[model samples]
Target: MNKVIKIENGTKQGVLNFLEHLITTDKISGVLTLRKINEKGICDYGFISDAKELKFADPFAPVMPINAAQTLSSLTPTTKPIAAIIKPCELRGFVERVKRVQGSMKNVLLISYTCGGVLPLNTFQGDGSEKIIADYYNAISKGETPGSIRPTCKACEYFVPMMADITIPLLGNSESESECSLIMNSEFAIQISKEFQCEIITSELDSKIIDKVLAVRISEKEKLYNKTKVTKDGLDELVNIFGKCVGCHGCSRVCPICYCVMCDFESHNFDYNIEIFETELEQKGALRLPPDTVFFQIGRLAHMSFSCVGCGQCEDVCPANIPVATIFKKVGEATAGLFDYIPGKDLEEAIPVMIFKEEEFEEIGK
Candidate 1:
């Protein structure tokens, strides 16, 4: 049974207050949420144990410094239970990581929301930051898609979380500005909510508005897929797109799914060997220094395409302005679709690559 709890203060404040309540009442040991670090309007995930410290917490901050799942993966399965308010994509990323043994949810209460998408880091750091945030919140209040969101966010259809223990429905509801509603999804969440000081609402969420946002996101995704479609025709288009890579590999660094401790791409194995260099020079007449730019991207795509959560962090950090997120999103969708899979949609569902059956894909051998 889903239980809804209504908070009297504004939505953002309500979340802060609730986190404080949870801490002060000993419901949880700490909270992991976005908190303002300085006056410059920068925010990042903060683990707060003191209820008074939640004053800096803003669970709805419109910027993502890093995919919080990576941080959660590093800190989780703690000695004590804690609550984390993460974006839908971040939660999904954590779920994917958990499946890979990169993280654990044993003592974590995952709270996610109907996401509004985040602004590109450049937009947030540039001038008019306040107006951008104000406009974003205004759009959010009306349950409409905010302008100037990241490309992946515009194309994201999975804005609503599937596996979170609790959900904050922010899409399409006008009352989101004046109050906050917590929808307890799991039995644990319901039991924990028994101590929360809020009114229980029995009404169902309005799906009409959510559907409108989803339709726009789907349309945007189709447009992006058309623009960034990698062809089986040749590597010429692939070379042209990734040719500008300076080999910084920022995309892989920020990718939550690329959980390797020492990436093969960065190892001595990829270093220039005199023999291979001479051979490549003889075969192709010339070589791109710091080789395998396209190979690295494709290699990662092959490795984690089925698990990419479309958080836009990779594209956000790309120095070359490569549409890394869009490409990954398109490829991930197609690859995951082949197995009738949705990454992070279910905890019990095994990843396609992690499981094999002899009866499956009979036509592949032929």
Candidate 2:
């Protein structure tokens, strides 16, 4: 059986209240989520042991390179009966990673929000700052899709959650009249629903509304892919777009899945021999001062393509205003499609990079 409930006006407030009840009544430990601004305007992650610290749940909280999955996996000794709030992308990564680790899913509660996509760091419609999202939240609690959101999001097909204990649909359907509606999936969610004892009502969703939103996303994606070709065209576009880039590399450094303790791209492998350098310098008028702009990006893509969550942090941290996330998502999608894989959708699905099958692509292999 399934239980669906809708909050009249205090969806966030209700969620916070539930978390508090879970901690006090249920005796759970902590809740993990993307950090948001608290009352003091301090930027940090939301961790609630007791009720006083629970901020209004903002699934789009920023400056977070590490998510519940990565953070949960890294704990020396994992904790149990904890609740984690994550976006669709982050939850998928956690599910996939936990399947492999197995130890990560012992007693965790998953709280997922229906994502409408997020804004890129360097390019957005607000006042040239990240706070525009928070400001938008304050102004319109409806969670307007960020103006400078990535094309991948506009086109992304993976909007639904398959593995969540409890799922919150942000893009409303028939219950547009209610605040936000909760759709319970797993038995864990049902248990939570029974424990909370909130109003039990069947969730009535508007399939047409959901379809319309997905159609718009798919349409935007096709147009984006149609607009971009292979890496060559992408490079010229990047050079043009990021002409002012200072090679800070903050994007990759802050990304959650760019997870090489030591990246080979930054290693001495690319340090050209003095003779080769002189020859190339004389042959061409001059090489770009940072020699491996293309190489750097390609290396990162190859490393994490199968696992790329499309968090938009690369473009966020770029000094040159480059659309790094867009390009990465395009490449990641192409490569993932080649493997017939979608990151974060299924925990049982094989990872393209870490695992392989012999007869996977006979047409391409031949």
* TM agreement with the true structure for every prediction: 0.96, 0.80
lDDT tens digits, residue span 1-366, model 1 = 467888997778887888788888898999888998777778878888999888888888888889999999888878888999999999989999999999898889899999889999989867668889889878877767787899899899999988888888877667876888888888878876678878997655568878888898999888878878665536898888888888998898899898999999889978778999999999999899678999999989999999999999999999988888988998899999989899889888899988988798888878
Candidate models: Cα lDDT each: 0.86, 0.64
Q: Count the backbone clashes (under 3 Å) in each candidate.
A: 1, 4
Q: Per-residue lDDT tens digits of candidate 2, residues 184-224?
A: 77777667556675677876444665676677777787777
Off by over 4 Å in 2: 5-9, 34-43, 55-72, 75-77, 96-103, 120-152, 173-180, 192-194, 202-205, 226-245, 271-285, 363-366
Cα deviation in Å at residue 194, candidate 1? Answer: 1.8
Model 1 ranges with Cα > 4 A deviation: none
Determine which window of 10 residues in candidate 1 has minimal summed lDDT. Answer: 225-234
Cand. 1 Cα-lDDT? 0.86
Instruction: Please give the lDDT score for candidate 2.
Output: 0.64
